[model samples]
Target: MMPQLRTLTMMRGTRARILRKICRNCPNLTTLQLHGCQKMNYSLLKYIFEKCPKIEKLIIANNLLADRQYAELVSRLEHLQSLEVFENRRGAGPVVLRFLAATCSKLREINLSCDYHPLEDVEYFVKAKRDTLTSATVRWTMAGKRPGCLPLLQKLDLPHATDLPDDAVVTISRGCPPLRHLSLTFATSLTDGALAEIHRLKHLQILDLSGCSGLGGSAVAHVAQLAALCTLLLQYIDDLTELQPSLRHVLDLKQLRCLDILYSGHIRAVAFEEFSVRLVNLRELHVTYEEEDEVFYKNVFAEMQSQMPRLRIINTFRWTENDFLTDYETDDDDDTDIGY
Candidate 1:
């Protein structure tokens, strides 16, 4: 018996017969990832769920499952803690969410794809799991408004939430005080006021404001106030012309490790130099430059890497010979390079 087999990942085209055998043998399986496994049916899933009663983390992405099937599957996993269901159109609706909230008392992390549902339903689930939930990723339209608190919640990712407003942000900040990782990617309606409200999350560590077109320099200024921040993503934020002077405020974040400023063309080279020099704990820096500034930014990255040996500079452009010639360099490394 493969009792020690705690994790299993099945890619696309996985056969149900093989899964059945594996699950039967691995009774202690704690984590299972079935990505793009189109062949999965309710009967097979139910069999696996019964066999692997110890599953604590389950990721089912890009598959097809109905709402009733989803509810049935989740009802069996009494030990479930982290659940992620992405790109599976029909399964993750109000019925499944409410069912999970009621049955999965130990559920802590939930990441679901963008689905149209009443804001009240989402709020109900959040309220139900408030004490146990630590991380949540649910993208719903802003059709309703309510005030609720989740004191134990740490991470909240609301990517592509186009209609997210300032008042909603205020409510979230005031409610979830201990939030550490907050992602508001493409939350276009948010402005400086929202950032001001988010500043109150004293323990915040990772902040992603990528694709947030409405934010300006003041937003950055508010972000700079979060002393505990380690990773900051400001990609696609076009308004940074007035940020040059207040850029000094960012240097105050002594614990910052990763900073992404991709497509933020307004920040000057001198400012980048200052950041590379002053931010002692910085380990990764992501940036993009215009056609004319390509060579200049390349040189700046090289210089930054030279000064901070531990720092990894990333950009959309291909790495040149003049860039850091590290031992891990390989031919397969393309523009979207992953640094060690």
Candidate 2:
């Protein structure tokens, strides 16, 4: 029942061999997201470039696409509009950015998470006039250094991430005037002061301030004032306990639909229940670390499913029949204890 298709993409878990077969057939397809494809090799990627000549978007998140492999792929597929090299540890963020900037002039979005040193080269590309460039995400976890790719972005995401500082946030607000989605998770250095600066993005839709254990209730209060925010992720914020109390200052964000409070450690079951009652329009909500409170998760899930009947998938597990967990499950499951 799918619509007349021009694209097919896969995420979570997709075998490389099957993907290669698909690539050979779908030459006219324009987008491909091969995330968590562990068996992905260089030959398959090259085959994609050779067969799928119309591909304009490619995403390889949390997958293994080495620097040389990426360079080779980029060199072959010159018609890409969006290129993502997520969670790569070989090169610096700037180095990868510069490489993409050099190869793909039509790139509209790039999400790079790398651990390389020195970001000056990447910064240069950000300043370049690429009219199509709109969405970007850059993360670097090295110590005693600041990455500069954030300042020149229009849309930014660093959800629950550690290591970036307050000055970097300020620089981003000052430089990237069109920023609409900002995530400042695990940024222990941030304070209430940082939120005030980035409030100028009138088009802002998504905001994440999870894992920022340093900020107090005031920071959450400040973010609630963002008029255009629709999605908010507030996981691991040790300071803010009760949602109604901490986020009481701005309780009238009627446009809000999604909220994530995973591993916050401070959220009480009662507070969560009360908060959900107020969110009449919420379509998606996630709160983890409540396994002991199975009743809470079940109730929340029930409420979510009832309110947002359009939900298609919900996955939370240590191991399942899914191929990604096949190896782990095979190694750990106690088969001898099973009477069946």
Candidate 3:
């Protein structure tokens, strides 16, 4: 009689009979991670819930669950403390979202993707229990789509927050003192002056200021001061043929694992060489193929490969003149349609 299992991870193609037997055998599982399980349905879920009443975390990523079954699952696991909903095909709609927000009194973190009505759902969840939440990720549901309105989140992740010439940046910085992760990709009106506000968020571990046009290659110095920064995404940030010392401040981050400064913004051959040498723990570096200027990217990539053999590169450079235009917005959001 083996029991007291606190965490269980079942791989894909895990048969229902075996899954049920496992659940029955170890009834104390608090964290169940069974992504890519095509056979997942109400019966298996019901058995799991019945056997594992103490479950506090559930991850059903990349799995297909019927629309109606979500509520049943939630109802069975009102005691859940963490949940992952959007990594699958059929997403849980507002009804289910609202139900979870209301019922899951112990919920401290949730990973959700929103294409439409992005702001409303997030606001509801946060407002429902302000003190309970410690982490939240409003991942962009579709790559083609951009994030819309967002609440005054400790971790603000708006695809586009209206960064007017002045008040917007101040408001953004002031709103999120508790911010740990901020992704303001393609943000409008962000200027060099705004760095003062952003730099104050020292708690930030992940910062994505990629595709920002208004910044115009001016804020990396302040960013380097963030002691907790780990992953920095700066794709197509500005026009630069070589890496300046100001920009090279990124090398200061001791914990940085992933750096995506593609589009060859001021990063020259020597700078790239220095970058490869400095980052001991670097795992991924994304850069564009400077076909026109073979001296820049081609040489840099060759040197990087030689220096760091274990690093991964996402070479889908596909850069165009339009890349200089960082304004990532479309009028499609005016309709306020919710993705169901």
TM-score list, all predictions? 0.85, 0.68, 0.64
1 or 2, greater by TM-score: 1
Candidate 3 clashing pairs, residues 3+ apart or interchain: 240-266, 242-266, 243-266
Give the per-residue lDDT of model 1 (tens digit) for 226-272: 88899988877665664545556778788999989877755572266
Among the numbered candidates, top TM-score falls to: 1
Candidate 3 stretches with Cα past 4 Å from truth are 1-15, 26-28, 33-43, 61-72, 75-79, 87-95, 116-119, 139-172, 188-194, 236-258, 263-266, 273-286, 291-340
Among these predictions, the greatest lDDT belongs to 1
TM-score of 2: 0.68
Candidate 2 residues 1-340, lDDT tens each?
A: 2223457767566677677777777777787776553455677778878888777887774334445565657656767877776664443333445555666767778666554424564454555633456776655444434434444356776644565666677666666666678777678777767776666665678888777776765666667666787888777655355443546543456667777766565345324444445655666666554345667567766765665565422324222234243433554655643321
**Error of model 3, residue 33, in angstroms:** 4.2
- Which stretch of 10 consecutive residues in model 2 shows the poorest summed lDDT? 312-321
C-alpha RMSD by candidate, in order? 7.2, 7.2, 10.0
What C-alpha root-mean-square deviation, in Å, does candidate 3 show against the real structure?
Answer: 10.0
Report the poorest 10 consecutive residues by lDDT, candidate 1.
61-70
Error of 3 at 50 (Å): 2.4
